[model samples]
Target: MRTKPVSDEKSQRKRFLSGNGFVPFILRRLLTSVLLVFGVTFISFSITQLVPGDPVAANLGQSAYSDPKIVAAFKVQFGLDKPVPVQYVKYVSKLLHGDLGISLSSKRPVLDDLKEYFPATLEIALVAVFLALVVGLLLGIISAVTRDRLPDQIIRVFSLTGVSMPAFWTALTAFYLFFFVLGWAPGTGRLAPGADPPPTVTGLYTVDSLIAGDFSTFKQAVAYLLLPAIVLAIYAIGVLTRFTRASMLEILGNDYVRAARAKGLPEITVIRRHVLRPALLSIITVAGVAFSSLLAGSVLVENVFSWPGLGQYAYRAAVGLDLPGIMGVSMVVATVYITMNLIVDILYRVIDPQMRDAS
Candidate 1:
């Protein structure tokens, strides 16, 4: 047959790969996520307002029956005397300007405190996530590949136990067993009591210490980080392992996998090349969603371990009914969740070309 010009063939292939329209699909999802974040923030703010006792009273360490004059003055100072609608408008406006308001308990700007603590939380969370992904995926693959074997049973049981245990309980247990009983690590806090916290560049002690060329501080921070990170990773490992196993099982049943087997490809190659890559798309999606929960859930673990992180800050703010602080934490979490979901959406396109075309 007469061959088409090279340019014409390339154009045909491009059209085929492009598939149908995608712009509207991507734009719509992005816009929806933005709206969801806004809605969540608004609801959280409204709920914070409805809780009994004025934030000023909470900060002032007074009962609800405090002097009317004192209460009035407190409200006025914090702008809480204004109508609810007015307050909401101000809050939304300030949020638009990236002003998270002042924390009543700390008497500092909420954003400033958040900036101070966020890096520690992010570091712990990142390390925990990395651990979870590596350990969970490996165990899951091994379990699936060695189905009906001892290793698979052990992994499944471990995942179940991890999922069933609460984070606080796990953290406390780990603290007692590892720190108190075995004397293997420090009991709590990000570093030893006498060790001076390195001067903050990023507020993450590990990174800041390394940047300052203080390896001792960095090592101590890492040692302190292990218990809490492991506690956080346990549940994540459970979730990811289940997801990976399910994805892998489905991928293994596909015709391409059978074809690879028929072609006498090694089992490892068939799995590593044909099965694992496809399975990971789902694993990555689950991991992203699970990561959002990790930060939010770390409050209990941080408290148990005495880690100086955003989770601890959030716990204090919530117990004290600090409106600015609670709102600040909520907004930060909402923003992170939205941002992560967006990144995952984009990554889906990269990992699965069909997703891009369908979009």
Candidate 2:
């Protein structure tokens, strides 16, 4: 009787694991991300400290750098004169309180600045990722379905060109053709000159404008967003296309795919339910990596387009030797990267039953 009860309990536990056990997976990812964020903050802070320029001097500028008393007072005020450990403790403490420090350039809080600019970068990145996924997956599936044919050759060559093209060059070329010559895209900003932006709800013009029932503002935002979005997507689209094509080709030749075909399944149904589902593991991995990379790559894209975004802000901070600004941007980027990786890991667990079994 005891053995029977124990067996029933074990079965219940097993069922729970198979059903709701992903909670532990999510917790593990969150815990691991916390550690990574700490490490990023520590390492980035240390390296910025080691950089030759003095923050006090940078903030004070060339004139007051010669004034020892002024410099000393400035360092003390900013806690730069404190020991490294003390400074780190204070910095981390402020970070925990949602204080990202002050941007010496704009005389604004870094958190406030990020709140203002992050949405623009996010808008572009999200659009770029969407375009990449749609175009890339379509091309990849077409290439796989028509393997070794002219269409496959054309897609491979096109993707190769995209991978090889320099982002800066592409940005400049697109700007010239689309904005300057053709006048299709708006000139170098997130809004047309004198065109009013939507009310500052989420800082995302498209959604915020739509929420406010402002179709005119939404249309303008989309026009301004399209060029940079396409430019940012070019590289990611190439990578995802190649990865998806390779994965799909392999899956299309699998025994199950052949069996599905032999069982009189429609080719489309077989590819969709059998081949594509199995191949999504690779697609998800590529998309996650691509999204993270696009966040970093926004620096160049924003610069070229003069978009009022975090990338431009980060670049300005670096040029002015603003350590707080740099650290804030670095931390944000690191958080995004780690969070995306965690999402990808969770997805892998979902897509591959073997991962769940192993856990």
The most accurate candidate by lDDT is 2
What TM-scores do the predictions have? 0.89, 0.92
lDDT of 1 at 171: 86
Off by over 4 Å in 2: 1-20, 357-359
> lDDT of all the models against the reference?
0.86, 0.88
Q: What residue pairs clash in candidate 2, if any at all?
A: none
Compose the digit string of candidate 2's lDDT tens values, residues 223-312: 999999999999999988898899999998899899999999888999899999889998998889888999777899899999999899
Q: What is the C-alpha RMSD of each candidate to the true structure, in Å?
A: 5.4, 3.5
Q: Write the per-residue lDDT of candidate 1 for residues 1-359, one digit (tens) a residue.
A: 33456567778766544434456456666778879878987899889978887566567745643778877877787788899889888988888898888887898999999998888899889899999989999988998888779988898899889888888889889889998899997778889988899898888888899999999999999999988899999999998887888899989999999999999999999999999989988898999988899997799999988788899999999988888899999988998898888888777777887765553
